[model samples]
Target: MSPRFEPITGRYLNLTLLGRPHRLYIEEAGQGIPLLCLHTAGSDGRQYRGLLNDKRITDNYRVIVFDMPWHGKSSPPEGYQNEEYKLTSRGYIQMILEIAGALELDKPVVMGCSIGGRIVLYLAHQHAKRFRAIIGLESAAHVAPYYDVEWLHRPDVHGGEVSAGVVSGLIAPTAPDNHRWETLWHYLQSGPGIFKGDLHFYKVDGDIRGKIDEIDGRASNLYLLTGEYDYSCTSEGTLDIAKRTGAEAQIMKGLGHFPMSEDPQKFISYLLPVLEKIRGAA
Candidate 1:
């Protein structure tokens, strides 16, 4: 049967976090258990547009995606551009906590990709009891050198175009042309230096290799799924984390760094089983 499209609502909320007030853009659909989805670095919540429109998942989950401050429709707090906006582990967790509290989400299943994926490790370690489960897509225990941050922000280079070109190389060669382009489109629109700032967190502050043992999978279901073609956060790296933390891990075939957007159908194929497991556990 063809899947029906569900109605999605977009709204904005002004909340104070990290000692500052910022506007956050949120898109939500369906009605059931909450699923808070976080987007890849430099990109916005638009990555989950397909899931928000899918009735099958939406029928069983209230899916919500939000743009981080300074990304997408969310406006940055005062003095954001003047001072470099680097993402910190503490600040990232605080943002999620604030958003969830404001939305009154009851132990939502938190999912994220790329840097979004990296942040979930912190969430699981720091606030496991607050979430029903945490799914880290293309997450790794340690993210070594893959893409150069300097090249991404060089004044001589066209930041957006160059960023898209670099990201395109990381996507799976098997991904559809349309899907690949659609995924690249987000990078092309991202603000300058935003990607680099996010990488600071992904490659540096987000490292949890030594602390993976601190996470209790029994209390907060931790799952790691990496794309077959993701060179940055390889499946081997993710599997290592899973082994260390006792969290479930899987490799998505024919997928890449941006699985949810690169090929939603293929992504869902892998995600469905994970969701079912979470539901059963709940």
Candidate 2:
């Protein structure tokens, strides 16, 4: 009997960024226009396994996903133990552009979820010409926190389980058990306080209410899709952003905060039309 092997290939790149040396893990499948996938906060590139394997999307796009430094197969920086790992908008933007440069991609289309979603807006506003297009899933400029993040990093708390528990409610009640648990599994494996650290950027540092007007949506070809069930990044907020920034927007039904991971099939159904529009424009 022949063993099964996925078309996906995983590799590591040695990158030194923000003045520190680090190793990054990346995966790719299919080929054509490069389509980069960014995972949600507290998770890793593994969240995109479904997208990489889906031929409908990959047949026309080179699907790429990477574990940010300190996430998934990517190890923390050389001296990570001594430092606090809070992510800042300045650092997040630099890391993304640097990764794109390192890969030598020719203006890849960027699609991001959650924190990944937030950065896509920044990319649009600051470097619209660098990408073919930007897609934000469960994205918004600013969302006031309903809970204290300190709970994700308490000395007595089991950070991983607690993080997963908090976000479990954010997934749609109808998400399949397999995908829902898989999404939470990523959070369950997160480094101590990494979830809390990433939120520092999402809830505080990366606020773009003032700067969103600067984005030329026509040039960036911005698309914003927020799940109807997502309390974290509400559909109302996304619609508001679409109105303010001239971005094409929609509210995904029967989905939640982690759309791509929680319900890839349904999410892809909606995503296919958007991809068609992007491809036609390209």
Best by TM-score: 2
Q: In candidate 2, what residue range of length 10 has the lowest lDDT sum?
A: 211-220
lDDT per residue as tens, model 1, 108-192:
9999998888889989999988999999999987788765688988789988898898788778998889988988999999898
TM-score each candidate.
Answer: 0.95, 0.98
The regions of model 2 sitting more than 4 angstroms off are none
> What TM-score does prediction 2 earn?
0.98
lDDT of 2 by residue, 52-132 (tens): 889999899999999988899999998888998889999999999999998999989999999999999999988889999
Q: Per-model C-alpha lDDT, please?
A: 0.88, 0.92
The TM-score that candidate 1 achieves is 0.95
- After superposing candidate 1 on the true structure, give the runs of residues whose Cα lies further than 4 Å from its correct spot: 1-6
Top-lDDT candidate index: 2
Model 2 global lDDT (CA atoms, 0 to 1): 0.92
